[model samples]
Target: MINSNDYKIGRIMVGASDDDVRYVHEADNLPYYHIGSVNGISMVTIDVIGHEITHALVKKTAGLIYQYESGALNESIADIMGTMLERYMLPNNWNWTLGEDAVTIRDMRTPEIYSQPSRFEGPGWESPGNCPFPFLGNDYCWVHTNSGVMNKWFHLVSTGGTFNGQNVNAIGPHAAQQIVYWALANYLQSQSTYSDARWSTMAAARDIYGECSNEHRAVIAAWNAVNVISPVCPGSGGRIAAEQIENSAESIMKVYPNPATDFVTIQLFDPITTVDLQLYDMTGKVIKAWNTKESTITFATKGLVPGIYTLKAQTPKGIYTHKVIINQ
Candidate 1:
């Protein structure tokens, strides 16, 4: 049995002394996760850990909303990462489905699965009564509950992992998740809605990989399969500003699967035959450098430590900057 002192979930570690972590054994006949303190604060159940962890990861990265369109993105992403993490990390406890582990939470698969029945509900994903064009066909789905549709979309896109005659093998789940994450965290704007998810994800993929990259192509195809837009999804005024820069000079410098775990694949964004690349730590000391001539470049940052570092690549054209992080 897990105690206040000994339990662990995914990459999160905590002790009873910390108030952010707490569990109650008798609530609803099963212990679950609660947000703040130990008493009167709910329990931290297993899936609750998943959802909470998702929220934490997003907060750390995009710092996206806690409500509305950003909220929907927030909720859906939580389900996607939480479910995926449970499937990958705690295989023994994996359910491969959202909210199935909870009685109070809505089941993402069947919106009708829960009686409250709002499209924005968290437990079950029902079509939102009304949504913008991208989500217009939306079945008024509740944010957390309705998120099942998007979660399923992510699962389908990431893992060749799919349902209902779709090719989920668009990209590796590991790679796809990272692509979507970076897009949401960096590429997406504040006013983005549900439909913007696919665009945001694909933009990130293209930015990380090349526009001609297979991952970008696969992501676009997957979005098409779900009726999501290829570029940016349009909202009320008929269009949004999310656009992939054509011949983006930003594409000249590349980083793959950011939030990287191992070696980061850096490719030359421009064709500078004579160029020097340097990496520096926070103290402004040079740590890694490469001097060579090639339009395509990749780096094996294996020995690099985990933390924030800057990659500066200079060519006859001037200077290019890329921020890189290695995850331990």
Candidate 2:
């Protein structure tokens, strides 16, 4: 059995180059890898523990597999969990990249690494870079490779990382990871891929977090920012978390422009770790979500039709709820 101490959070093996992510013998084991040599980077191996562990958690909790959209989502869950876990251990600024934080592997937040799309560019999966498997029959053999899109998206969405000109006061990674953990462990169905996985995740986010919690918005925005197949959110949606809920046991969640016209901003109490923000309509439906793993989050309402909306956020310990409105 592989000693737990032998493995790291983002990367499993030090010399094992077969794959970046390895299932180190431990309670938390899954796909994905980390490559680096810095103390900060080496510490990321421990972060790998959470990423792989999330895989097991989802496998047992959601009964997801390593194939199709479900496979992609499974990979995404691992990546999200892995990065969040690593971030949890180390401070920001010093920790970045999924592969070679210690040795310069890949950036977790920036999807377009070195001017390359995180996902493979064509239907033909055969690549020239480090991705080992050849995309067969349009088969997504690039599960781990393509997952970079969601990985960077997760990092961005979780922490209010910017894409174009959006500002997000995201919740934090701790909450976001826990939410995904619950989602993979409980809500998600099988045969889920990128789109399907996201849809299930939205529903799960709604259930655990709320209808239009920042977590929900974070999910929608995260997918939107990535330009994935538009996640089918119900037309009529509602609110999940409140920036400042009154007369309730809800946690302290905050976002600006409750009824936003141009942009919606998000904020938290402490130094944020990771959080996903989601938006919704009136009829208990999903609109879009964002993953803000940083300290804040911002989303644009320019395209929105203009109506009542809600934002949802997923934190490390539990779910946070908030409300927002778009004036367009």
Per-candidate total of colliding backbone pairs: 35, 102
Candidate 1 per-residue lDDT over residues 273-307, each given as its tens digit:
66788776544457888887666666666787776
Q: Which stretches of candidate 2 lie over 4 Å from their true place?
A: 1-21, 24-44, 92-94, 114-140, 161-169, 229-328
TM-score of each prediction: 0.52, 0.51
Candidate 2, residues 1-328: lDDT per residue as tens digits? 2336765433344544333444433345433333324433353364555656677556555666565445556766776766666666676643545544444445666645533244334232224344444354333554555666667556655687655443334757765665565455434667655665555556555545665667776776666666553333345253323222211113445677665779987766544566666665553446787766565667777777776555656666655545466777
Off by over 4 Å in 1: 1-43, 104-141, 161-170, 231-247, 250-328
Top lDDT model: 1
For all candidates in order, the CA lDDT equals: 0.56, 0.55
For candidate 1, the TM-score is: 0.52
Using TM-score as the measure, the top candidate is 1
